[model samples]
Target: MLLTKVVALSLSFASVWAAPSPPPQSSEVLEVENAFTASKTAPKFKSLKASAAIEVYWHVVSKNSSVAGGNILDSQIAAQITILNEAYSTTGLSFSLAGVDRVVNATWFNKVTDGTREQTEMKRALRKGGAYDLNVYSSGFVEDPRRLLGYATWPWDYAANPQNDGVVIHSGTVPGGDNAPYNLGHTLTHEAGHWVGLLHTFQGGCNGAGDQVADTPPEARPAFGCEVGRDTCTADRLPDPVHNFMDYSDDSCMTEFTAGQAARLTAAIATYRTQ
Candidate 1:
């Protein structure tokens, strides 16, 4: 059994727009009602429900970090695991991953000191192994949660590389940790949004529909730098939902997922992850 949180995870994308575009900038004040508008038509969630039980096999790689021991990595992994389990529980899906199945073991391997060949090969090996598992079960979706390959390791940019369906996480960047892992859980939530197919509300560079989900408002860029509220994108008069998990906001403050996004992710997993 799993406990359901009172607040729903706010995930959304634009459905009307097809092509990617830049987001418009604004300085208008947004109201909650306008910020959140019910979609005329909602995407279906059958596909997500149909997604098969996903088994994550993490390939733990080491990089230059101040933290000693595996505690930092372990902590990062734990945080993601918690969020993933929570998401699966809501959809009545089972999620499990082999604990750090592989290790890069190159904590001391300085980029300048060591040749790139070994590291490149290491990443290739990880991908190959993950692909093998995807083929083994003929799973529709295969994901590598650890920060292997070339992806962001900090907590601020919660971006996922969709090409490989791989998730990169830096333990030091998560919130509560020192300077690196700031607002990490939120970052995980955001990247996980990408993991399932959600995009940034600001889109790329704040001009186009960041994710293309209708329920989520289009913003010029992420908010939070200014202590006071600011609206980057205002269609009518409502401010953007910069605080949404899909956006780059503080970890503790970000939350909420629109019904449409839930439907989209649910359908995505079911279509791709189904065994």
Candidate 2:
């Protein structure tokens, strides 16, 4: 079961916005969220939920003068916080940068993935705080750079993996950085959605519950570039959610999240993470 899921993850876009680079394999076997810690399987979230203001603490692991690997600028971290807040501005939820800490370690800088003992140990040593605050770990890479941009734990996972309950991101994906197409910082937005219990808009393909949000159209698969009118589910009246933040379109292409999504995400946060 793990192999089947992880292999499919290799094919899906990997990250919060999980639009990993195209693979030689087929899209049918695909996944969006990367395995950033001990989680190798996709999580299923069904109930519609809503949100509240969230405080975020930034835990930056780098190889600078500190104790891990390379470092990111304070300015860069602030900018990402700004972008994150902007993404949730309309959802009745707000994200503020509560604090910032940097640890210098080369081993952690280069590699961390889902299902790895190293990842678990790393998170255990570095993770701080509880469900009341969002813990974000920024590094140079996660799992396979060619396939994953980042991965985050769902709201409920915090209970089982409190130390691992946060989003792991590729440092290059920050805004104003060089990670093109995904450089705008929406990756955090996408991951934040998952952190609040959102599934990919294309999850379960063109059929079934279709991401469990009534407003979001069922997408057959992750859309690559932004094609405005692309429709993969001809049998369904709703077009593919190519532009949703949950889809794998380019950062520039991602525009909105449905009202239903906002409600469900809010509810999830409330259910899992108490104030």
Candidate 3:
């Protein structure tokens, strides 16, 4: 889930946190997301009847032994799955780690930005399982001047681009890691939301059909830090959802997904990911 604007934050560790580039929000993508909103009819995908268990294939792409270079430990990866399960507890979707593979490649580790040749090659070589299985690549985006945290592909894009259907995260953002404010493992949670079928909480920016969810109030922009009671869209009755995982808020600031979001997740999983 890439944001439109790049937010440059100077942290105590002197690490700069910049937003990732935007995913393609074309009409087809919008239609796929909005389809759940239009009708409550269950999708043809069979595995999404009540609850769906997604198999996660973890791929660690590193330059060397350094964790900063993307060689994250198995414990950190397990901690991330725990965080994701807690965050998505109410969504009726759960993730199980199917396998973990580590690839030591300096070129792939440093150059795996969104839509780049390096990213394509890396995913094609490392991606595992079918559309239902989640392939998570922990890699470095050092080549990008903005230092993107992570990005994900939509479920609708899987048919045409099966190899690209997965999530790429900055290895430093895992739990007990160096990237502060984002190290609590919420980056994967946020990107996983996109990987399923969620638009940003601030998708339409106070315009029509914001995030296409009925429960979440319209948000004018992404919230950076924990700005409690901050209301950007004054016309709306509720304050900004800075605590939502889908926003640009820090890991500590993110909390829960709304009921509408849960419904959307179920619908999206049924509609796209299921067989």
Number of the predicted model whose TM-score against the real structure is largest: 3
Off by over 4 Å in 2: 1-52, 65-70, 142-146
- What is candidate 3's lDDT per residue for 100-162, written digit by digit as tens? 999999999888877679988998898988989999999888887776788777666677778
Task: Candidate 2: give its CA RMSD in angstroms.
Answer: 6.9
Candidates sorted by lDDT, descending order?
3, 2, 1
Q: So what's the TM-score on candidate 3?
A: 0.88
Report the poorest 10 consecutive residues by lDDT, candidate 1: 1-10
Taken over the whole model, the C-alpha lDDT of each candidate is: 0.39, 0.65, 0.76
TM-score of each: 0.58, 0.80, 0.88
- TM for candidate 2 is 0.80
Q: Give the per-residue lDDT digits (tens) of candidate 1, residues 109-173.
A: 22301123543454455643332122000000112221211121111111222223344443333
Number of clashing pairs per prediction, in order: 37, 22, 0
- Sorted by TM-score (best first), the order is 3, 2, 1
At residue 180, what lDDT does model 3 achieve?
A: 79
The superposed Cα distance between candidate 3 and the true structure at residue 26, in angstroms, equals 8.5
